[model samples]
Target: MLVNAIWDFDGTLYDSYPGMMKALAALVTANGGQIEPKTLYRQVKETSIKQFLTGFGQQVGRSVADLEADYHQRARAYLQDIHPYPEALAVLKAIKAQGGHNLLLTHRDRSAWEILAHDQADTLFLGGVDADLKLPRKPAPDAIQYLLRRFQLNPAVTAMIGDRSLDVDAGINADVKTIYFNVDGLNAAPQADYQVDHLIEIPPLFRK
Candidate 1:
């Protein structure tokens, strides 16, 4: 049977941490605050910008909205450098060649999608959900359900590939298979149907 996979944009398909870390450092410094690089990187990975900024603001006595606005303004230029992970495009091509369908399910906004579309013009993405859609984000199952209904995909044959537990939760909620892209085996979550350290490792799992 052909497989349908929903890929997470940030840590799974793209290596967005470098740019995000740079942006966070600049934003915090501009606000007369300081944050360790490692801590900021982890925070960005595990928490939403709004949640991180809300806590950061409470620490430095600034309004969350104001800080988020400033960070987003400063982060625009940083996003320009965002790039896909090595072999990500190749993996996508391999999957498609094997009669698989792919969709992007991310918490990113349209700006992020524009960046990705520019970087990889030929990638086969059925459609994507952005923050502007106002659908609940990852771990909420709303976006996955939308995709399943839109594509008429079988829940058992569809998969969600992501690097976080939220991704697994989303897949479970949507009644789809889940693949954990644990490059370092850092997050040992047992809920994942499969765990892989590299993008290319995915193809074999779908072989009939």
Candidate 2:
């Protein structure tokens, strides 16, 4: 079976959570606040840093704008830590070798292009739609819907893979098959067509 894909960049294809959480913890501490990496990370999983920052500002005694600026600076500083997860590239290449369209949909900003390009994985994608496109964020189907039409893909043969429930929800909203990359096994029962504990477990779910 031929397959087309939409992948989430940050946590699914990459192990960016540790670095990102550490950055958030540092930023919070530098501003005279106290938040552990694990605590903030979980909050972010349910919501975005921007959204989380609204209330986080009050707790940390800073303005939302200031907090956002701090986050942007820290994110750039931590870019080096955002390497591709082991075995992720192999799966993507295997699918591409089989004549699939692998499109990346990430909420990560345009700054990610430099990192991806540096890693030489940017060209592996057919195309990418990210924050630069200014689409509504996940749990909203706008971005996926656009990709489906742009590629003229059949929803049945396409899959959206990501590490969070929002990713699964977006794929569900778009009416495509969803694969949740629950590596930690925390998502005991994600509302996805399939659940994978590793990136290498992905290709078999669709390529067959």
Candidate 3:
């Protein structure tokens, strides 16, 4: 059966890690604490900025709110660095050619799409719902359900493609197939229906 796929934007579609790391490092230093770039990157991936900074502030002597504001300010320019992963655009094109329906579901603000929409012009994005929308982010299934209802999709034939465990959980919660795109088995989520190392491997899954 033909399927509709919902993709996660951050680590899945675009490699925003480098820019995120840069922004986070600057944020840490600006708040009078010193943290290694790699360490900051890992922390950001594992926890949200508010929680991460709340913990960090306790270690140093600062308020989480101040640190968060600084991080957001420093991260403005970094958003422009967001770019598609290698061959991701080509893979998306192939999915479109196969008559697969595609949509984007992310925790990022809607404005992030204006900067991140490159090469995705051909896909049917229902626009970003954003974290501020108060809709539960991935792993809660709210965003997935919204997409399904909006697009009139069948959960059984639909798929969620992403690089994190949250993506798999979201798909499972929404009763859809989950495709894990972690090439190195970095994220070992139990809900995944298929595991692939590269974007090019996606097209074969639709084959009869």
Candidate 4:
């Protein structure tokens, strides 16, 4: 049975991309640049917020820090609209019921806690690593390594569940099982150890 599950917060657990897209759109418009929403979505999903913001800043002759500041402020408004994915909470509950502990590891900053708290999902996590920690981002494995060491978790029976390649890479780097949550049919990371279409399908795999 899986004894420890590390979760990704944004697209993995919460439907946050729409809110994130809104924030990015507002930032681009404020900079007097027009963006194609689908293109922006694809770019962000394939790369990252930092990469996209940095590239956009360079294109529009703005500083990345300035754009990030404005974008984060805009994101706060939309964060309230973000919610847990259908059956996401149920999966977390199931993990806990199986005597496993659920933890969070996300690129989002402390604001991630806000969303979890809002949805009353914060209690499901034993702890987390967020951007506020100033740790290296996904694919680096620094954050996941820290979590494993700090929690005294064994990687063999632990799993990292996420919606992106970086998340799977982090898990691989940390020597843990990787579960790719490909609900969007994106098929982005076929290299993951396991892939699933729905959150409801998860708990059974770890059942004792």
Candidate 5:
């Protein structure tokens, strides 16, 4: 039986892209750099913030630190405004009801997504580890490994779910079941143990 869940905060649970896009756009524009909406969206969906900012910095002739500072400053104010998918709370509650322990790991700052978690459904998460924790980010397996070891969870009973390929890679790296929340129905899917189109679809997989 599935006993634990490691969730990805940004795209998997919360619809944070719109706010993130605005933050990136405002930061680049304020820095006198122009980034097309399509370019920003594709990169954000594909890579880490640091990677994107570094590439963007090179493109715009600014320090990554400068772009990053502006982005984070702008994002903090908009963080609380992010909302989960309509099915997110229902799925979280369902997992808890089935005796699964839910944990969250994200690249977002601890101060940012935590507000939305409290505002939406705080009770569903057993714990959350974020960038503030100083743990290595996902696709490295450090954070998830820490959670599994600390909690004494069996790897076989754990599943990681996220919308990005990085999320899948993290789970695979950690040797747990991985679920790709393919909301976009992309023709080229990530390598995951399972794939679901929506949060509501996840519960049935665990039930089996």
Candidate 6:
């Protein structure tokens, strides 16, 4: 009876971390700070983009905002390489076919929709809240609350799927079930209603 599925963009529906990591690597190099790809990935994955940028800024004698501005500008080139996770579209279509409304909840702005549109996946979503809306970021539940009210989604029948702990935390705060897309095998699991390593495993959870 899961009638609504709220998805996270990067690392969840789309394999965007590679592009984002490349952009960060290039940014670090341009700022005369060296970072290995694996090291950069681990740091960003374990912490977050903002945390990574904060430390990078200090190392390069720049402000976080300045560093982020530069990173976003550089990211555009790399981001074009982004694509959906394997079976991600299939899972989305399955949800839709089962009469479930798929929605996006992400910190990314228009670029997220642009990416989904390129794959024609944008049409599957009922609606979403993006960063441009200026809602409090995930783990806050403000954006998810807005979606619940606007879409008349029942929290009991809504599930939030995301790759990060904050995403699960936001879903919990919003009073919905959470599915943690644990692409990497973390020893300590987030307290999600369900956990899966692949997109193909998702649709079964929502089946009647």
**1-208 in candidate 5: lDDT tens per residue?**
6778889988788888888889988888876888799878777777677788998889889898888887889987777678888998888888888888888888877664556557667667888678888888778889889889888878998998898888889889999999899876652345888889879988876643
Q: Which stretches of candidate 5 lie over 4 Å from their true place?
A: none
Candidate 2 TM-score, true structure as reference: 0.90
Q: Each candidate's root-mean-square deviation in Å?
A: 2.2, 2.0, 2.8, 1.3, 1.9, 1.5
* Model 4 lDDT at residue 118: 81
lDDT of 3 at 89: 78
Most lDDT-accurate candidate: 4
Instruction: Score candidate 5 by TM-score against the native.
Output: 0.91
lDDT of 5 at 125: 80
Clashing pairs in 1: none
- Which candidate number would show the highest TM-score if scored against the true structure? 4
By summed lDDT, the worst window of 10 consecutive residues in model 6 runs over: 181-190
What's the distance in Å from true for residue 189, model 5? 3.8
Give the higher-lDDT candidate: 1 or 6. Answer: 6
Please give the CA lDDT of all the candidate structures.
Answer: 0.80, 0.82, 0.74, 0.89, 0.82, 0.88
lDDT of 1 by residue, 1-208 (tens): 4398789887788887677677778988987888898778666555556678888899889998788778777767778677888988888877887888878887777876687678773357777677778898678899999999988888988999998778888898988999999864566446888888889899776644
The weakest ten consecutive residues by lDDT in model 4 span 199-208
Model 6, range 1-208, lDDT digits (tens) per residue?
5789999998889988888988898899888889789888877766678789998888879999899889889889877789998899999999999878899998888999999999999999999999899999878899999999999999998998898888888999999999998887662236999999888888877755
lDDT value for model 6: 0.88
> What residue pairs clash in candidate 2, if any at all?
none
Model 3 poorest 10 in a row by lDDT:
119-128
Q: Is candidate 2 or candidate 3 better by TM-score?
A: 2
Stretches of candidate 2 off by over 4 Å are 60-66
